[model samples]
Target: MWGRQMFHFLLHWMLGAICFGFLVTAFSVLLSQLVITVVWCSLVIGASIMQDRDLSEYSPTGSSTSKHLSCSHALCEESPNCASPKQPCPYTANYYSENTTSTGFLIEDILHLASSSDRGSKRLVQAPIIIGCGRKQSGGYLNGIAPDGLMGLGLGDISVPSFLAKSGLTRDSFSMCFNEDDSGRIFFGDQGVGTQNSTPFLPLEGKYTTYVVGVEGFCIGESCVDRVSLQALVDSGSSFTFLPDNVYEKVSKEFDSKVNATRTNFEGSPWEYCYKASSQQLLGIPSVTLLFSVNSSFVVDKPICLVYGTQGDNHCISCCFFEV
Candidate 1:
């Protein structure tokens, strides 16, 4: 079963890479905007009813912190949208909070939309989505932030790419080009794999699905590799890559030795390795080189130095691809 599935998956992507460019140009009407813009109030409330589940029942604790909500209006202090009893309450999504070991439930939802329509035909797209609908914790830091939804584009059947392909609107392929300002466009359909050095994303053994890639090791400072081999998940869902405790300690020591590292923390950040200065200015600072299989090496330098602050004074230099 696995062999055949892998064969077909790769086959479709190969065909998609070859034909997507022509399709985008010729049938411009098929080019659809790759985003979910909104969700109506009725659907949320109705889905809760339809599933026979009260969104309010599932909370991080056996109880809920939203007691401040007026039973008369059923509204919380933070958001007025879930004001009515008819409105859908957020679910307790588990493992959604990375900072703590709290347990939560999974909130599965659906997205219905039309792909980008050129001045021509219109096609509606329906996708299955797993939404993380809880705060980083039960309180202050990112509390009440879960109501706003997030879209996952992982290597799973429920992901947007898989949904589009299954719906027969396009091939199982997509590409993205982004700018330094964070503005970008995602090209779907026969977006070719640029260059022949493209590496195949390997399948993982566990229940959770992800695009696991084979990593040889990380080379710090120029292209020198200290010989570390491992498998890593190429998860775009995460803002920072996570490593095992021992491995993180080793890398942290090496990073400190290389660069005069200054550690800082945000009010809610879950990271330990942070820097106040830009990545370029760190003397003897190693350029992070990720050595993956098939001779695929990713070098990080510019984006490594990120400015993160409400007032624009803070900067952080972080690196990791979740390794095991």
Candidate 2:
């Protein structure tokens, strides 16, 4: 029989710590971005895991309680290189960034979770979960990207959420709400409010491994500048929003034309359409909105962001955008 479990965890920015009964580990939240959860292996010195405990006791490879998943496991079947049933299951993940990748083996370990009782008291529960013990990492990972480890919330057979759901520990659903101060809470097995707006998830190559939604077009203020039919992936792990090259040009140009400010540039910055404007002037800037099917729309209230220059005297009004 399947059981439904719901739990909440606090997040500071993109990082959060989950207690595993005997140990506490910090992870970067990759909401609906990655297909598998990953923890750096003991081989990587100076990792948070190693600094938190003795090398012998906390090592995933050395821990007697941790078990290597066999290649014959169901999760291992997704790998194209799984040949030997007796061998450990291997996994690899490639990111959108160039030369960024994580390759490792899968292992099973116990995860400690806090659950609320019917009386409103909290209690600890243990469950087995599969994790990718990453042995090697490259590219942005070495440069403070998920410096500790990653907690993948994407849709996949091996993801933590999916594993918990398959084990009948929780319903296969989760929700994340981020606050203005960069703090947020995540609720597992949460079915959101009935009045909330929703967009349908689109399938990719006949598989629903990532959250993809259809976008009809974009609006800058009251004017609808461009009409686009594309599928957008909702990824919270990304610090900035990305758009197609053609759409990016139209939107940026439209935004620049509407604002009454001088155009400026910051060397080595990703923002191309920056403006030299005062705070009072920015208040009159137009808002950005995304149009979806069924008349559902997402509004960007504060589209212009204040970016300080190196000298700290100059300010630039920037929008998060990168052509994909």
For each candidate in the order shown, give its overall lDDT on alpha carbons.
0.42, 0.64
Candidate 1 residue pairs that clash: 20-190, 32-116, 33-116, 92-105, 94-104
Which lDDT value does model 1 have at 132? 30
Clashes of each: 5, 0
52-166 per-residue lDDT for model 1 (tens digits): 5322322222222212223233112223434564343343222223442212223334445456645778776554433333333332113322222334344455356675777
CA lDDT, candidate 2, residue 66:
76
lDDT string for model 2 (1-324, tens) is: 001322121211222211111100111124333467676664453344235533221346455457888888877854457767888988777765557678888888777777665599987666678877888888766665654456677787777778778888778988777788866666667778898878887775677866667778878888887688867666555444556667777777887778887777788987887777777877878888878899888887777667778644333333444334
- Residue 320 in model 2: shift from native, Å? 7.7
For candidate 1, what is the TM-score? Answer: 0.51
Q: lDDT of candidate 1 vs native?
A: 0.42
* Collision count of model 2: 0
